[model samples]
Target: MLQKRICIIDDDPIYKLITKKLIQKTKLYSETIEFNNGNEAIIYFEATSDLPDILLLDIEMPEMDGWEFLDEFCKLEKRINKESTVYIASSSIAIEDKLKAKEYKCVKEFLSKPINLDKLQKIAEQN
Candidate 1:
């Protein structure tokens, strides 16, 4: 299996912990990084030369929401790695949110929250 670096950008610590555990269980990622919000992730992206191969983002956050992150990411897209894949992993079931996600070309998929191990495995396989 190809071991990739995965980044989880969510405000909920519990969610982050659980997701991290699940990601580890998949055994497909070399490293897992967590960010409290989109802003922190953006800062990391700006500073780090080693960017994540996969990004799991939450729509609702304190510092900067997922949508805001997408916007900022778009601006920094040129500087960042084009191979990086972004997935919007939010609890939101709103159709509007899903539609909004489609507007961003960087987003590979809009996944519902509480992503299971199977989903993680599939994501890893696809990428």
Candidate 2:
């Protein structure tokens, strides 16, 4: 079976590290890509055909936030992989944030910060 590809877009290094480790422990993805900011992630997505099976996006970042990234992502002419799924991973508990996330068709779920193994496992199983 071909392994899944996962991408983590966040400004927090420690969060990225821990998330990556947890995902790896699940053996869900064959490879994982990390981006410091949404701008960098957008650049990579625009320039390459290698889209991930799942994208874990953070709402707060220096360059571009998750909302901004989603806007840019919507503008892309090329379609994202049909199997690709995006999940918003953030610390925001604001109701507005959750509602906004729901507006995006590509977004599958809104995960709280410090994603746990159970959530990862469930996501992995679903895919």
Q: Candidate 1: minimum summed lDDT over ten consecutive residues — where?
A: 75-84
- Per-model TM-score, in order, reads 0.95, 0.92
Off by over 4 Å in 2: 77-83
True-structure RMSD for candidate 2: 1.6
Clashes of each: 0, 0
Per-residue lDDT tens digits for candidate 2, residues 1-127, read 5678899999999999999999899887899999999999889988885678889999999989899998877665247544468899999999999999999887899999889999988887777
User: How many residue pairs clash in model 2?
Assistant: 0
Best by TM-score: 1
lDDT of each: 0.91, 0.87
Candidate 2: residue 41 Cα off by (Å): 0.4
